[model samples]
Target chain A: MALFATCLTDTFYPDTARAVVRLLERLGCTVDFPLGQTCCGQMHFNTGYREQAKPLAQRYAGVFAGYHAVVVPSGSCAGMVREFHPGLVGASPATTMTYELTEFLVDVLGVTDVGAYFPHRVTYHPTCHSLRMLGVGDRPLTLLRAVRGLDLVELPFAETCCGFGGTFAVKNAETSTAMLADKMRCVLDTGAEVVTAGDNSCLMHIGGGLSRVRAGVRPVHLAEILASTEEEPWAAIR
Target chain B: MGSNPVTWLGTPPFPKAAHAALGDSQLRANLRKATGTIRAKRAEAVAELSDWERLRRAGEAIKDDVLSRLDTYLERLERAVTERGGVVHWARDAAEANDTVLRLTREAGADEVVKVKSMATQEIGLNEALAAGGVHAIETDLAELIVQLGHDRPSHILVPAIHRNRAEIRDIFRRQMPSAPPWLSDKPVALTEAARRHLRRKFLSAKVAISGANFAVADTGSIVVVESEGNGRMCLTLPRTLITVMGLEKIVPTWRDLEVFLQLLPRSSTAERMNPYTSVWTGVTPGDGPQRFHLVLLDNGRTNALADPVGRQALRCIRCSACLNVCPVYERTGGQAYGSVYPGPIGAILAPQLVGDMHDAQAASLPYASSLCGACYEVCPVRINIPEVLVHLRAQATAAKGSRGPEALGMAAAGWVFADPKRYEAAQRAGSLARFLARDGWITRLPFPGSRWTASRDVPAPPAESFRMWWRRTRG
Candidate 1:
């Protein structure tokens, strides 16, 4: 299986890439990144710059030319590749194929867990793209269930958007803050110390809300949780 | 909002109402609050079902079948309605529909008509049309009355007065209702009674009522109005002349189709297992309900919309508020931004489809309204890929002869760059280099429509290195 460490994880959040790679390798897959790969053109496509999105599509197609399947850590990026790519290209043949991280971990790889352990009262925040766009329902939950000693408490309104819709946060800041407050209330309701999700974008929004409210809960990515075990930082404690 | 098109939100392809709506902050806030609540609730309700995708597919199939054979079902419905002693009127446009209803009211010798909360009526501006014909159309639904009396256009699809908080509602009731109790508080009960009192006499005395159908069942010649309150029942019954105006796309071929929509609509929109008061009326009877039943089938721009294969699928909309509830764009700016009777995700697609892509900022801006989030698609009772349709429309708008300069130039250059990988790599390298030169991580300034990108949010600067470059350095 090949992993597409999305531009975000590759650049700023490198630890997330390491965790994704580590978790996949433990699941017994030969993870590879075709060096020729670039961005998914999601930003351009979403911003109504369809023309700008096309090159990224062709570049992605060109880079992932011979790969069997491409998995990305983020549902948004993966959705851009899977749903938007063919759409942007529109009958122009492109060989690149992709799946969201949790989806590939559950669907193609058929492994719910990579034999990791994290004993904590944590809740899952379903990213907007993960829940609605990619429709990656329960694939992450299926993996989380396998973790040894993980409580996996459910977050209230887990499926509601945390209002960090790419440029939406700045575009409609007041309404965005209002929605984030509602999401925060739901998160705080679960009494879970940590909020886990498949995408970092959503995590950052929720984490920012937590920071603003000075809430005790922290946001963690699903990749990091899956990549942890008894020998790692998230191992069972005293 | 200005008289000229200079301050228009988009190119001169938008309808008038959308352009006007941009300036109304109170309406925007009301819409934002109402749509936000519904959108949140929809997610909660949808998540409970394990086979949501299957349900969406089923809904899509039912609506598609109905829309494809719409002519047949409509004919069957008209025949069934006539057989059951209900007069059927076919309207070619909003003018014809309103004229038909007003003429019928005059024929019935009724001066006033009680109204159900119907989006079609709003779309056609039926109340104002009736007023022009010297007929007073009184809205009986709680939220609608607030909007009607306040002289406000509805923001959200489901809760028309969604923009109003309880206190604002109380103020509207206190100021507008002649029979209002002087101590009407912001409490829900107080507000309800105030509206009830204001509308009670209208419902009892009004000899005619105009409504829009949630679904027009062709098999049974039935018109269904799904709502949370019983006020619809008052509008459906009581009046001697009950006229149900419907969009041509509101038909379902059979009871099985109704079954699929029933499951999808309520869950997707109001977050209920089923609508509380789903009044199903099929023509008239000896002494039951209305003595005079009239069904007006409205085809205002629907056939034109249907002619386009890609866009015609939007006709399958069940008027379920589900799409409105789950939309992020709707959650923010609220439903008023689309500047049509229809707002939110459906409005973005449907407004352009129902009304011709007009010349103004509102109509032109409607296609680009969404972030292409696809939440509306997920929540739609009928599985309309709203995002796909939006993108398609945007492309259409962009490709039109009137394409704007900045967008056209950018898209043209993009077409060349995107058509090749090596060219894309060069562009990315150039972009990254430009970002380095700019120093500031986010681009605060932009040129023209690119200015819209920087209008609110930071244009995330190109990173120091493209992922491909980093991959090459590490892998090589």
Candidate 2:
């Protein structure tokens, strides 16, 4: 088993990568990090640079081909791998092998309770790609419900996009900001101290906004909360 | 149609228009309220149907079937219409459609015509064209009347004056509508009463009526106009001559096919259990309704759209406006920012393709206007893969521009680094040097092109070690 630490999770939020590894290993599965992994080329392909994305996508398929099962922490990248990669990489094993972390936990690993404890009122935002594109329905929630000492609260407009659409946040900054404002409002309404999601791209956008407003709410990746245990509690977000 | 001679407005690209629109707090508030209410209602209406996905698939299949063998159905439609005593006119473009309408209006010997709310007429700038040829086309729909009275372009497909509030409607009526009573109030009921009174005179006396149909049944040659108000009925019946400007893609092969559409449309659109009025007229019926009927079947850029395998799915649109209400982009910027009669998620895909010129800069900007949110696709009754088409169009727009661009160059360079493990690791190692830019572990600002990212939200700084680097050291 191998983990595809998506570009953002690898370079910026390696803590999420480590947490995923810890959680999977704790569930009695050996998780291997494929050294050749770099990116899924989602940014290039989505931004209309299809030609530029081809080699990277091919590289991804080549690197992960040997692994019978590939787990990804970010739902957006997992969706790109499982859904979009087939078209780019020509029906490779990676397409069928790839799994977003939550789906990997509940379906493949066949466990919802990972023996984790996070004593905080947390609201979960279903990232657009995870909700619509991947259709990993209630898997993340099922896991959250099983966590010891975790107070799971419902997010208003949970299905709406957080507007952290890779290049979209930059290309259309104002509209992105406007959408983020609505998402932030919903998060505030939940009265939850922590906001969690399957993708860090959404968390980064949301956490940045929360930090700016001096809002005390913390944005944690789903893996970190799941990795926390009574023996070794997860560290707070930087 | 591809081009609007009278109503083109030489509109600026999407970003510029959206920038201005974002500044208008009132417009934002109005748009937020309207789209929110409509989206909620649509969701509830759709949930009532246990077989919603089945109906959506049927709707898609029906439209796809029509598009695949369009000429056959269109010819059948023409034959059925002609046999029923309705004259059919074929329009290849906006100019042709306008010319046909103007000629028909002149032939009818009437300088004025009453109109039903129609996207086709709006697409062709029919009112401006008719006025240019010394004719007046009075808008009879309540929302259309508000837009006309305000001297404004429609900002929505279903509700043209959705950008304007009740107070603005009152102001427009007081200032522009000559028939408005002096003491007209801003209340919606009052506004509707005023419009009803104003348009009643036009409906009764006008010699001609012009409209766009929701569905044109090929089997019976019956045109359907589904509306909330009885204004569409008045427009279809009272006039001596009725001219319908229909898009070629509106055809449904059989009357039975209309069953799927009847179930899909009203639920997807006004979120009604059933529309208040549905006018189905086949042809001229002497003494019963208009004695003369002209059906102008329009093919403006539709063939061009159909030519692209990925893009032809856009033609499945029933003008339900469900996509608009769910789209975050349309919610923020409103319809005017799209710079075309079609706006929102569907507009982002349809306008560029309908314009059919990838080099057209204004149209090119439409594809990039969205954040590629799949809300539109989820809510669309016809299952038009809007984001898929948007990405497809973006590729075309990129191909036409031909790759000397900076974004293209940057992607190429990144692709190079990512294709090799050593190079990619080095790039990751190089990225960690950006710790200087990090303030409390987040980069708040950056240099040059990277500024686009940091302009709004803070970007994460590269961690101290790449995951590959950490993995190798720990596991080697």
Candidate No. with top TM-score: 2
Give lDDT tens digits, candidate 1, residues B354-405.
6565354456567766545577776677777787777667666655534466
Chain A only: TM-score of every candidate?
0.92, 0.98
Best by lDDT: 2
User: Model 2 captures what fraction of native contacts?
Assistant: 0.58
Residues B1-476 of candidate 2 have per-residue lDDT tens digits of 23543125578878778888887999999999999999999999999999999999999999999999999999999999999999999999888999999999999999999999999988878898899999988999999988898888888989989999999889999998888888999988998888888888888899999999999999889999999999999999999999999999999999899899998999999999789999999987768999999999987788999999999999999999999999988988999888888989988898887778888878888888887769999999999999888888888888888878887788788888888889988888888999878887778888868786677667777888877788788885
- Candidate 2 Cα deviation (angstroms), residue B357: 1.1
For A1-238, candidate 2 gives per-residue lDDT tens digits of 9999988888888889989989988898888887877889999888887777778788888888888799999888998888777787687987789999999999998998989999999999999898889999999999999999999999998988887888778777788888898999999999999999999999999998887776888899999999998878888422
- What local lDDT score does residue B67 receive in model 2, on the 0 to 100 scale? 97
TM-score of chain B of 2: 0.98
Per-model DockQ against the true two-chain complex: 0.19, 0.70
lDDT of 1 at B103: 92
State in Å the error of residue B302, model 1: 1.4
- The TM-score of candidate 2's chain A against the true chain A comes to 0.98
